[model samples]
Target: MSDPHSTAPVPSPRRRVGRPAGRRAGDTTTRDRILDSARQHFARGSYSSTTIRAIAADADVNPALVIHYFGSKRDLFGATLRLPLHLRDQVSALIRTDPDDMGEHVVRLFLTAWRDQNVRTPLSAMIRSVFSDEGAADALGQFLATHLLGPLVAASRRDRPELRVSLAASHLAGLVIGRHILGVAPLARADIEQLVACVGPVIQHYLTGRLPAVPTE
Candidate 1:
């Protein structure tokens, strides 16, 4: 070695510096902007109507960034449509109590949950998607059947409870769709107490009231 003690050429501190740090910060900002824009777009219309390019433009970011952050439109939609309540747990608790007035309790719980800001936007988006997209329709039906209906049916523990649970759930679902989703007339304008009074007995009938059985003859 000509000079073992000689120091190796010092690496330039400049080599360690450039746009990487700035680029990373910019990326994070861009991702947040994209998500905010996406939520706004989805809230105003169905998922089918909100395009990725439009969201990217609204966010003031490149289209690629939207895909990079949220993967696809479906994935983004799902992310945006999350509920405020722990639906399974809440419904399970309500049904487990075996209340005599289950319908009133259920309706109250539903209305209260829907009134939350976080819940309302997602629910509105889901409702719009269900009407406009076949995939969304299937997803929403499956979600309702599994989470909403399935739990109540399992917890009913009464005779021929499947039919009862399904009927009750259908009635409640229709009420919500008409009033909240479709914004139907009197139903939409009706106060919460009025709705509960009008709808509770129908659900109660489905849940517990006796019906004529088919004749064996």
Candidate 2:
């Protein structure tokens, strides 16, 4: 006979079989789910126009979950856009040692990056958004400035004594927009080697060569 005050052995707390409670663990499936949703929304249009609620709905999760996993929309976009290759490191190395052939490197980088199915599909959408929407342009500009340009400048500090990195960067940016994004004639059709051959000198000039002097009185 058990005493009236005696209690039966308590069952151990059962661990959840599926996704953990509160916050899902930082597992691949959760990340993939978030990324899938992000791609859907970002590919549709601009990052600014894509709401967290919409992303959550598409992902089939709570809105708070996105924030919990990715921190912010900007972070989510970055994650989605991040290529497998270490672009900053690669570009930095190219700018430092091959400043003379920066244009070829730029073209190669763009072509390679776009070749990747994951990067290309989303990047195409980003390019479209940049042209069609103001908010997208601003967001993309900020992202590029912070991630791409900033790193390139820092990397070239040793080699670019004159510090004209901006000019070089601008030239590369123009080429990318014209060739890949806009699909301009001739440039779009040109083979990689032809483009590299044509554009390499222009980039070299921007990097280290002196500019033409203006007429003076």
Candidate 3:
């Protein structure tokens, strides 16, 4: 008979304790997977209910890894919803310098960003994604607080910061969509200077001027 040890079957190799091979838990691929999972969960009406554990499961990562990559669910959502630009820095600069010209500067800055195909393309996608994905609305609202409305709010030394933020946000959103997205008559075709002249004051008012009083019932 063959030797007992030689005839015996070899034991299977033990799997490693760490994350499986091929991709690291903290790699870009893993991060993108988390974001993609978040986007899917948001689009599927599960945003409010989704958890870090769920997202990690979907991404085949550990919950600790999710926390490692994004501190919390809201932060994960923010990461997923972030635009492709350094919005805070750019807007903050306009808000800081040239108080008198800040409004026009803001308009010009917007027009300039939108004029670039690279900027417009990603921005369009982000806008559409933000507005259409209602599941992510709360997260989007939080993000807008910092990304779009934060600058105007920061620039203002006004009474109601809420009013300033809301007013500026509404006006800018309308301006962008009306001009670039919908291509609405005069706004769509109007010259950049004309837009700056017309819309600048409105934004300026929202930023630094007095707001209309709320009527008591």
Q: What's the candidate order when arranged by decreasing TM-score?
A: 2, 3, 1
Tell how far residue 173 is off in model 3, in angstroms: 1.0
Candidate 1 — worst ten consecutive residues by lDDT sum?
17-26
Off by over 4 Å in 3: 1-68, 71-77, 80-87, 115-122, 129-132, 136-140
TM agreement with the true structure for every prediction: 0.62, 0.70, 0.62
Candidate 2 Cα RMSD after full superposition onto the native fold (Å): 5.0
Q: List where candidate 2 sits over 4 angstroms from the true fold.
A: 1-28, 86-89, 92-96, 158-170, 207-217
| TM-score of model 3 vs. true structure | 0.62
Error of 3 at 182 (Å): 2.3
Of 2 and 3, the candidate ranking higher by lDDT: 3
Q: Give lDDT tens digits, candidate 2, residues 1-217.
A: 7688878887999886743323356766877887898998888877568888888877777778888888987778767776555776676676566555665676577566667778776666766777667655555555544555445545545454334456655566677678878889987888878877877777656655676665699
Clashes of 1: 0
CA lDDT of every candidate = 0.70, 0.68, 0.69
| Positional deviation of residue 163's Cα in model 2 after best superposition, in angstroms | 8.6
lDDT of 3 by residue, 1-217 (tens): 6786786678999877964332665578878887787666654444555677777777777788788888887687777656446644677676668766777877777777676654554345445555656645555456556765665667666678877767776677778888876779888889999999998898888877877788899
TM-score result, candidate 1: 0.62
Model 1 Cα lDDT, one tens digit per residue, 1-217? 4787888896767665422222243467766576678789878887778898888877776677677777887766665554545754677787676556877777776776678776677667767777669766654555455555556655666677667766776676678789887889998888998888888777767766675695797
